[model samples]
Target: MSKYLPLSERLARETGDQWRPTLAEIEAVLGFPLPKAAQQAAWWGGASDKPHHRAWLDHGWRARDLDRAAGTVTFHRDPTAGQPPPPAEAPPVIEAHRGVGGMALIGAGVAVIAGVGLLAARLMKGRKA
Candidate 1:
């Protein structure tokens, strides 16, 4: 079967928006019966994982609103390939800085408290009162 078809491109151009093509029509353009994969719904899922989707996908057409019971698939020109996510509004960044002087002051304060605690402990241990 022909891997690609001119009809797909022509249809995308002429239809300009939505084109519902029957399976028979697709096969006719392809010049052969579609492979078994075509019968699978995923074949028209607009995902690029399968080779069968390439025929229409290459022409920038994507499947939409697939109706399995009705045996119909709507193809739409998806040049955007789905639009990109809207730009995120990031939270403003906050910078915190502790200078060497600030750290040293904290350390000194801890040491003074420890010294006082030790002195008090020693005095209480030595005295009856």
Candidate 2:
């Protein structure tokens, strides 16, 4: 899609708070014309859950000083939120039962080895007798 989501994200990261690049500057970052929705100012707002907004919001940016008549928009980064933390998920739980299973496998191997040794010793005794 021509949402320019990736391009918007790059611009937000590349520009500092004082830096306000014009539409042309943004297009240079994009390397192409603004996307269908990107061309409109309303699409630049962060309040909406529009897919394009996430491209900037995820990177700590929100639209500001947008001059539609002049074809310019400035992106301001969130100082407090320099980076958004990853979404919350269940923490990995480690259990003490793991080592018990491994020990069981080791014990089985030792038993087999002992049984084989006993059988070999019995065979040797029978052969000698």
Candidate 3:
């Protein structure tokens, strides 16, 4: 439902590996004027998450070489397109405390609580004496 869907279709139809469409040309395809942000080179970067970027990226194109002065953006066919991404390595396993160490920690905590209780009882008894 992106407004730039037409641009996606247009780029999909392009036979060349590279396309340098003018801002005006892109706007024409979108049936609207480009936003003020589009004047910046960063706006045409290869950020696939962006709607405009997705227009090209979904069609196996990646925007680069933005010429703001000339009001043009060069989109090259993504070489990695249709290829599977490299497999991510499994994360390192962290061993949890599973023996006496863990039990000792719990035991120490209980001993501290018991010691505090005994101290409180002794203080109370001395006050009552």
- Candidate with top TM-score is 3
lDDT head-to-head 1 vs 3, winner = 3
lDDT of 3 by residue, 1-129 (tens): 998899999998999999998989998999999999988878887455788887887778878888878889898998674344699998865567447687999999999999999999999999999
* Candidate 3 weakest lDDT stretch, 10 residues: 91-100
Instruction: Provide the overall lDDT of each model, using Cα atoms, as 2-decimal numbers.
Output: 0.70, 0.71, 0.85
Ten-residue stretch with the least lDDT total in model 1: 1-10
lDDT by residue (1-29, candidate 2, tens digit) is: 53666665675567466446677877787
What global local distance difference test value does model 3 have? 0.85
Candidate 1 TM-score, true structure as reference:
0.50
True-vs-predicted CA distance for residue 75, candidate 1, Å: 0.1
The candidate that wins on lDDT is 3
Clashing pairs for predicted structure model 2, backbone only: none
Candidate 3 has which clashing residue pairs, if any? none
* Model 1 spans with C-alpha error above 4 angstroms: 49-51, 82-129
